[model samples]
Target chain A: MKIIVCVKRVVDTETRVKVAADGRSIDLGGVQFIMAPYDEMAVEKAIQLRDAAGTGSVTVVTVGPAAATKELRTALAMGADDAVHAVVEARMGPNATAEALKQVIDGREYDLILCGKQATDEDDAAVGPLLAAALGLPCVAFVHGLTVDGRTAIAEREVDGETERLDVDLPAVITAQKGLAEARYPGLKGIMAAKKKPLETVACDATGGKTELRSLELPPARAAMVKIEPTAAGMQSLLTALRNDKKVL
Target chain B: MAKYEAPDFFDLDSLLTEEERMVRDAVRDWVSDRFMPVVEKAYSEGYFPKDLIPELAELGVLGGNLDYADFPRLGPVAYGLVMQELERGDSGLRSFVSVQGALVMFPIWRYGSDEQKARWLPALHSGEAVGCFGLTEPDHGSDPGGMETKAVRDGDGFVLNGAKMWITNGNMAQVAVVWAKLDGVIHGFVVPTDAPGFTVREQRGKHSLRASVTSELIFQDVRLPASAILPGAKGLGGPLSCLNQARYGIAWGVVGAAMAVYDEVRQYGLTRIQFGKPIASFQLYQAKLVESLTEITKAQLMNLRMGRLKEAGGVTPYHVSMAKRNACHHALEIARTGRDMLGANGVAGEYQTMRHMCNLESVKTYEGTHDIHTLILGRQITGLDAFGAA
Candidate 1:
């Protein structure tokens, strides 16, 4: 199987994100950026399938400024054969990201394409399905586990309290989840080798904004964690607040 | 439909420079992807993951923490944050690095001979070889000074005789930093565990720190060349310094463990039902969760400041004592509360809280007992001698 895993460089999950003063994007001031969490799972799943299947090239593609190369190289160091960094503006919306990734994967024959269900920073989660749509392939979301056999793919998904199983064709898109597999760490030799790996830089065909952000707005302030007694009285008091103050009880 | 929000709300912009943020985030991503998923499993199985050491080395987490580079951190906070996040998965795995980076690697870097360092550091840092610290003997828990372990200077080398207990990563170690009294002066040595007379007996049936391999090291007159003595190190201060580094990291580490247990319990409380409603509706559950968050917050703040102090070179044992003690205690409490809130299921190894709760029991005792920090603070406040506190 020829698999292409799409990853994104986003704000660190633990970072204290603030809205940009312009009210159209997250403030880069204090935010620490990192590889999106689910993308990592996607990368791991792709690698696992490649290894278990005993054949295939795992290519990681990321869309961002030059800094995105680091996460791309990291994927390379973790056993990916090569990488493509599609440079795009940081303020690019989900469509821009998907379009940029699209250009990178275009005309490249691939049997399977993998992606994180969503990026933690934008949390739009549209990039995977969008890329699949742009490429015109089958798509599955919130997949907890995945496997590939010949021209078919198998996936496990969580629903309500029970887990569901899914099947799709080889030329499909899968959004990875938590239990797929644990990602492996790169050894020092790999870390050293990643610096010298063949990372190809490509231009994105974003073709401008598919969706324009008029402005970026900061989320409303969270109410301080006030003590709420978990009792009838406390429940009633909360209910009263909804009924009397915030309305819609 | 729901939208996700970020967890960072700290007004710490003024506190950190841009470069520090880059280094911190890079390390965070590395650990989250590499360590988090398998950590709970490693901890529950009571096995130190041999594979991840090199991965950590590749991320530069082992000794890159204390060294200077393009990132001139104002505090050891970067290092602290790394440990904190590692422990968020499980403490035993973090302790493995603690034993190497802080315990074994630091000493060799600080005190090893040029030859010794050249021979050992690169491999240890690369995680090619597992390293551990053996300061606590069966009889030398808190009073390492009264250690019965002895090293007699032989013809061209020294012969070591002793048994060390509760050594983290011990049974699996390729190397160990050992302290033994020599000619009335306590000194440290870098002993290869596979040396002729050296034997590492894995401690069995442990209820705590099951993920980390605990062992009793029996050096039955282990003999090695004089080169084994760390040239720059002599006396208790050497081992103590290594312990301080580990403890500083531990102070940050336990907070992560505390956060995990608290998060689990809070989630459980919010969803679990009692009396025909969510038990989170109870004031008692709220109190438990609130107090947990309160402690976690305080510990986080303490560690953040402590990191800066460490980077600023103003960090002393007392500085580390404060954070380590608080974090250890809170982590233990949080784990216990987590188990309690979950009722019988908490005791099972399925959830991470029970394992961490059990592990913290050992973490609390090692590096320095919780009571040791109380008295270290006491000594700072009042000029009183308290060997009795030991």
Candidate 2:
């Protein structure tokens, strides 16, 4: 099972993000970049499938600037065989990113294409389906559990609080959810080995898609809490305040 | 409470290679996620968290530098970073790795016969077999050469008799690399823990390194085969070389402990209110923080240079001694300052300052005391042995 996992390098979720002086984008300074959490699940799942087959390759593909190779190398360190960086100088939307990934993955004889359900940065869940459509393959989204046997793939996805099992044929795209598998920490040996693994970079000329970013701003601060005593008079006052001041009863 | 943040004041991450950063980040994540949650409880309970051994092995931290075919052969700097990250959690955790990797597996790899290496290295690497280095006896701490543990030549094997004290992982180890006198010359012996007449007793009531398992090993006429002796080791040079390896790791490990305390106190100062504002607003606290950061940065640079030299095979015992001494001394001071900065909260384990401060006391004393290292440097510069005489 030759698997290709699409990953992205995004600012760590834990980072305290600040808007750049330019109103259109976030400040990159002092921000730590890590593999997108959902993409980590995808990469881990690909590696697991490859390992279980006992003979196959797991190649991680990312679309970003040269610095994105750090995330690619990290994926490789998680036991992927190689990596492909579709180099994009500017931030690209889901369609352009998917187009770049399709270009990089062209001519690769991959049996399975995996991607995160959504990138945390934008939460744009369109790339997997877009890429799969462009490549003319069936797509499975929000895959929490997946198993492949011969040319058929069985995937379990949670839909409306119920698990929906789907059987997809070979050459399918799957977008992994959180519970795909617990991502393993890259061992020291794997880190050292990742340096020696092949990482190929292809320049991508990504035209802007239909989406445009007008501006970025911090969310409004939360309202302060209202405290009331435990006495009946305090409770009556709190109820009156909630009904009149906040307009919620 | 604020989350614990690691302080990397100098952007030292850029100094490391990509692979080095990955290794460090992985260890840092593991330590923060797994070790931090349980360390205080483990320390208070006074027992090593043995459940973490498998995870440590999976991370390839055990014997990480040794070139076992199945194990990760990380660079010296990477290995040092592992020690640093582990010590960031606690010194006892770091000591466990140091004893296993440098003291036990290193000797077996460098001195043991091919057969012996094949028998022990893989098991030790996988954490299936825990091992300890037995050199420090009850009477002998700094001067291991005067160890009374002796092995006499018998028909085919040697009869070993002696007591080793303050052995880390002593009670938990399945095997031990013991340094004993053979015909008045120090030699290394691989002794199984379950060998007849060999008894291990846990040393209880330790305020320092309480999370670690320190025990006493007594060999009462224990007989071992000739093949059990490390073939490539002879005289005091053998154990001393192993100590050098461990000491080099200690040099790096203490920096992590210092960083932990420095980070904890720095956070505490920022949020801790006193006299109308955070204590961090005070000049006294600022001065202490500056001092600690300065010392930690210096130690980081020293260890980086030492690591490179060691990787290049240009490092000498004197270099290791200087680094170990400097790092330990500065770490102790940083821990103390950090403790003081926390004020009354410093005495509590919840703050983590007191734990690091207590752990450094043992770190300073072990792997050659700070004074012993000073004499080592003193001898190197002055060409005079100030160790024994006035």
Q: Pick the candidate with the highest TM-score.
A: 2
Stretches > 4 Å off in candidate 1 = A1-249, B1-45, B66-75, B388-390
Q: How much is the lDDT of residue B358 in candidate 1?
A: 85
For each candidate, how many residue pairs have backbone atoms clashing (under 3 Å)? 12, 0
**Candidate 1 per-residue lDDT over residues B1-390, each given as its tens digit:** 011111233555346543444444455556556666676677666677778776677666676554423212223766776687677767787888888888988898899887877787777777788888888988778788889889999999999998888888888789999988899788889999889888888988888777788888898889979999988888889988888989998988888788778877777777788888888889988898888888887787888788777667777888888888888998899888878888887877667778888889988988889998888788887978575534
How does chain B of model 2 score on TM-score? 0.98
Taking all chains together, each candidate's TM-score versus the true structure is 0.67, 0.97
Segments of candidate 2 deviating more than 4 angstroms: A232-240, B1-4
Best by DockQ: 2
* Clashes by residue pair, model 2: none
**Separate DockQ for every predicted complex:** 0.07, 0.76
